[model samples]
Target: MNILNKTILVTGACGYKGTVLVAKLLKAGYKVIAFDIQWFGNHLKPHDNLTVVKGDVRFPATIPFEGTDAIIHLASIANDPCGDLDPKLTWEVSALATMQLADHAVRNGIKHFIYASSGSVYGVKEEENVTEELTLEPLSEYNKTKMVSERVLLSYSDKMVVQIVRPATVCGLSPRMRLDVAVNMLTMQAIKNGKITVFGGEQSRPNIHIDDITDLYMFFLERPNVTGIFNAGFENITIAEIAEILACKTNAEIITTPSNDPRSYRVNSDKLLATGFKPKKSVEIAIGEVIDAYEKGILVDKEEYYNLNWMQKAIL
Candidate 1:
């Protein structure tokens, strides 16, 4: 599918990954409709090819879908912590609303529907490398919802070209920066306090740079043939390993603590790689980018930068 002249609607357009994906689409000459509740303030600068909409994904009837060639659904109760806060809200936004949006897109004759699922759906596995075919054992409400949503989207294969990407924990700087994610949180802690905390650092974590994942979203947008579930992480490194790298770069002491969060799994992205998708950034490179942002005064350690903190104040 040639997305050069296509109009794409990106839900959660104001989010960390959403903001990056929206910009990439506009730069590639695709008309972009950015839909979000703006729980976070709008960070995107206005563009001629961009149309921003403030609305919830649960109400697909109210969101304009006419002339939309595709839909990239990203809006959600985001992470494990947020999901734990309200499982009902998580299901409504992440799973139920996603299924509703896909149904609506199909009814509107939308050609492609890409669902932003998470690698966390793999759950706490002892497996060295989890793949798309593996039975999902989602441990958290957040991932459970994503798993449900993926199945729901794929059920519409006959009606619309459905694709589900289980993206790894994304790290890197963005206009709408998030400090809650692992690499970002560790980098921020190191920069701000000169102390890096590693909670049970042996657990494996699959991660992809923010740019790489967002670019993958763009790649799937135009490549209609690549449909189905695919894991999108480039590297699987342990928490201690990540902290060691951050310590070397930031000169912070590694403080170890028994982990309260034991979720861990190494993901295999060979399937995604086979599609000729090359990840351009690495965890080390993402670490450097976060440091650069700090040096430039672009990002700081604040409640606003952390999702859980902000959501507590912003939501209920």
Candidate 2:
């Protein structure tokens, strides 16, 4: 599965993580096809090796099984808030279609298939931190669908090589930007308004940069034999520490509130590390980016943010 010169298809290409990874793959000499139902066109990466295909994954026409060496499944109702918006569509497109994609790819002779699962699958790790072996207790709709979809995809292990990477709450830069995440939101609030609302600071959740996430995919794409599910994330920090540091960068105030343990506990990515993979960007680096974006006046309006509506519906 050496991606060099291999034709690779990246779903959700316009998304934060997908966009970054698509660019990386294209730059690394992989034949890249980008697919997405919609586009933040202004943020689209202009590349010679990239071919943009506007399509949805739910429909068979969009799967593009032919001539595809690997399928990176990133298309879905990503955030918990967005998934709960329309439960039925979420399953049909995000969960059910993953199974359909696997069937299409494997039956069509696609070599490698990767699923972007979430750390939220491990709800609340009763024991301080969680690991890949921990039993899943997904508390939200998006993660529930992810867990179900993962099971369905894994069923094809005998037919074709399938791999899953359960990334922690991803933060940092993206072409199609989103500030609905904890780090992004805190940095925006502190910079614009000089204050940040903190919730459940005591809870430690694993976090990783958007770039590092793409790196994980590249590693697996190059070494397809590295199969199975692996956890991805660097340090597990509490909401309070994040708020404090973000405020430090912005010279803003910190506001703490009730339990807002929206997703999960911390996770141990040791298993993934054993695969000779180390995250290039850390949580601290993500913080720096957020602060830099804030100072540079790039933080968009709350209403204009892609994830604002989704977050409001779920958090409220």
Candidate 3:
């Protein structure tokens, strides 16, 4: 699939991951239509090939799907806390909207659909390597919505090439920076407060850099034949390990505390790697990038950077 002159429709285009992905699409000579609700604010710069549309993904009729060669679905009530804030809204935007979009793509003769599914869908797995074949035991409304959305999209596999990526907790800098995720949050705490807090430092979590995840989207866009659910996390480390890295880089103190949240899982991206996809960044690199961004004043800890806080004040 030569992406030259092809138009790609990206949902949640102004978001943390979508913002980076949209920019990459435009640079690769693909005409992009970025659709978003703009809950936080639009951070995407004006481009000749980019069309930014302010709209809700819940309303599929409002989506600009005409002349779209592919759809990269990234819109949803992101994270567990925000999804739990309003269960009805989460289901409407995440699951129901995905169903409608897949159906609409089929009707409009769109041949490719790439979905952004979460690695957390394999909730609290005890297995050493959480593979795509593992049973999904989603623990939150957000995870359940992603699981349901994946199933819904897979149903249309016969009609189109469906690529589902179960990416681990994404970290790193973006045009729309997010400071709420584990790596970025702890890094910011170290930079701003000179201390890093680790709640149950032994709990391990898988992570992928924002650049690698967005690059994976471009890889999928070029290879429409690679269709199925594939994990995209490259690094699996403990909370203490991440904190130790940040502490080393910023000369910050590490404070460990007890935590009731024992949920921990390590994702394996062997399947995705087998497809010739190479991840170029790591969790430590993501932390370093965030620290550099803050030191250089390119990023800040804002109220909107925390999804739960912003949604509580504005949306909820």
Candidate 4:
């Protein structure tokens, strides 16, 4: 798409994945407009072509959409527990805001729209391979919001290149690191407490390294023609399997406990791979990198790292 001179607006630019993606965008020489509520604090380093805007996505008019060639919508309440805390707020930020943004994008003549949807939207699938064709059965308010947002964005596909990526639970390090997800959370537990907790270990969940998922966004950004819902997870392993990998790496104890959560499914990214997108990282590599960061003092266990804990204190 020759994005060298193109300007891209990235919502949630201060978030876990957003921070990394924004940085990469700038490094790749694309003009970037970073929009965020800054609920967690902006960790994005200053760049020559970067424009950081503190604004709410609910009001699309407030966002600086002028001269924007594409939109990478990443803003949302994020996670099941945090989304559950305020269902109304989640709907406003996650779903309605997306509708507003897509409408604005169409009006503004922004051609490329890449949405960060959740793999959790296909909630609790019985099939071994949960493809994008499967009917969405969103269980939580968060999942439902993502599902609704996807539908809303898809409705505008004719006007713009609507590329939706249903990414698996992301792991690895970021400027705004999150220890709440499966891989990062268990890795932190093993590193800090010397114990890895496994709840309902048999339930398989798909996972992708943070780098791969972020890279997938850039992939979609460059190829605006390749549009549609595509899963982005590479590893489909159980909770126990993840814990065992961490335990071996950190010599931590594996503690099995009962879990009633029950939400589990393996996401297949075959469609994504067929489009020439290659995943270069794994869960084991993510665990190793996180451990390296912790040991090197680049990362730590903080209140903001856990979304539910921080959101309860900051937003609620």
Candidate 5:
């Protein structure tokens, strides 16, 4: 299952995680095929050993699956703000596109298929460590579609070596930088406004670094012996705790508000760790990296705020 000799197709290759993962795949010497519609519905660049396909996943289309070893389906309009932008568009792309991908990949003899699912698929995992077997209670429209997407991908399990990973709220530095994440937003507020405001500061959330997230995908891709579901979070901390971490680094005031924001949960990534996947980054690391970038003037804001549609993390 070495990636060096394999050919893999990663959907939405221009995204925050996708771009970073694509770079890693190339470094691993995989014959990488990147499918994306960056802007104006076009695949921007061409590289040696890399092919960019410009098309929408919502529409049934053919890929160069003849000798492809695997498919990492990372394309999706993730999050409530982004998905709610256009409900019709979200449904078509997220759920419908996923079904087409599974059906086509199997028919094309693609043996391994890795689906980029989310922890949001399980709306709230209360007391116990949330595992693959937890009952899903999706609160938002975006989450509902993701739950459906995972189910559809699972239906093709018998044909393809399907592995589903429900990653926690991803944070960390990226070349395609974003400030929409809870951690990133707090960092920005602490730096510019001198204070960070948080809603439901007591709400516990599962967090993971961006690099750790990419590593998990590659790990699962190479390990065919491991199948089924796994959670992808490192530390379980509260919202207030996240702000406190940034405050220590940025030296800003923390403002708390117990809003009925309706979001809280903790994840158990023990299953993923059992597969030799140990996350190297933490909330502190991510907060520090971002704060450093801002203080050093490397990531000064041209945009007043981050938008779900623009933030590359919105790509599941």
Candidate 6:
């Protein structure tokens, strides 16, 4: 499929990853219809090829899917904290809305549907590294909804090229930044508070740079024929290792705190790599970019930049 000039509808287009993905799509010559609720406010600049729409995923019927060749579903109740706040909302937006959009896309004759699932779906694993074939043991409502959405989307594979990418904890500098993620949180805490706390420091989690994940989405979007689920994680590192890296860079002391969230998993991305997709971005690179962003005043210290804080306010 020659993806050039193709119109794509991107849900959650104002999100941490969505803002970056929208810019990439526009630069790559794809006409983008950026649909989002603008939870953090729109940072995307005006573009002739870009169309921004303010909307909610919970009510997918109201969303316009007209003349869209592909759909990149990225909208949801994002993280564990937010997901736990209202599991009902999580199910409605993440699981139900996802299927609703998928059905709409198929009915509208859309060629590709890319769902941004998460590697967190693998949950706590005794295995060294969980592969695509492993049975998913999602620990949180967020991941559980992701699992359900994946199944729903895959069921429509015959009608459209339904693809799911299970990305790791995405870390990097974005126009709309998120400070609640593990890597970002640790880095930000070190910079702002002069201390890095590792809650359950030994727990392992796979991570990828934000740019790498968006680039992979474009990779899948361009190749419309390629379908199925693939893990989008690069390397599995411990929480303590991340804290140490930030501590070394910022001269901050590492603090260990007891955590109730003990979920940990190492994801295998060999299937994705076998397709010759190389991820150039690393956590070290992401940390540096974030630090640079902070120094330059590109990112600010605000509650809205954090998902949990924002969700609490939004729901109330």
- The models' CA-based lDDT, in order, is 0.90, 0.80, 0.93, 0.93, 0.80, 0.89
| Candidate 6, superposed: residue stretches over 4 Å from native | 1-4, 258-263
Q: Model 6, 1-316: lDDT tens per residue? A: 4557589999999999999999999999989999998878999989999999999987877688888989999999898888999888889989999989988888888978999999888877788888999999988999999999999998899899988999989999888988888888889999999998778788888999999999999999877767799999997999999988888788998889998868677889999998878999899889988998899988887888888888778754
Residue-level lDDT of model 2, residues 1-316, one tens digit each, is 4556689888888787887888788788998888887634435677887788888789966567688888898988777877887788889878888888888887789878888999888876677668888898888889899999899988988887788989988898776777778787777778778888877677777899998889888888878779999988788898888887776677788877887456446788999999899888877788798677656877555452566373455432
Counted clashes in each candidate structure? 0, 0, 0, 0, 0, 0
RMSD of 1: 1.2
TM-score of each: 0.97, 0.92, 0.98, 0.98, 0.91, 0.96
lDDT of 3 by residue, 179-270 (tens): 89999889989998999888999988899999999999999999998999999899999999998898789899999999998877788899
**C-alpha RMSD by candidate, in order:** 1.2, 2.8, 0.9, 1.1, 3.1, 1.5
lDDT of 3 at 266: 83
* Per-residue accuracy of model 1 over 38-157 as CA lDDT, tens digit each: 988899989998999999898888788998999999999989998999899899999999989988898899989988999989877777889888888998999999999988988899
lDDT of 4 by residue, 188-232 (tens): 999999998898799888899989999999999989889899999
lDDT of 5 by residue, 1-316 (tens): 5556799999877766787788888878888988775631332345698888777777666455567789998888767887887788888878888898889898988999998888888876565578777799987778888899889988889998999988888887765666787877788889899899988798888888888899888888778889998989888898899888877777789888879866566798888888877788888888888888887888766441355645444443
| TM accuracy, model 5 | 0.91
Off by over 4 Å in 1: 1-4, 260-263
Candidate order by TM-score, decreasing, is 3, 4, 1, 6, 2, 5
Could you tell me how far off, in angstroms, the CA of residue 86 lies in candidate 4 after the best superposition?
1.0
Evaluate model 1: give its TM-score. Answer: 0.97
Residue 140 shift from truth in candidate 2, angstroms: 1.9
| RMSD over all Cα atoms, model 6 | 1.5
Stretches > 4 Å off in candidate 4: none
**Global Cα lDDT for candidate 6:** 0.89
Relative to the unseen true structure, what is the C-alpha lDDT of residue 57 in candidate 5, on a scale of 0 to 100? 78
Candidate 4: residue pairs that collide: none
The CA root-mean-square deviation of candidate 2, after full C-alpha superposition on the true structure, stands at 2.8
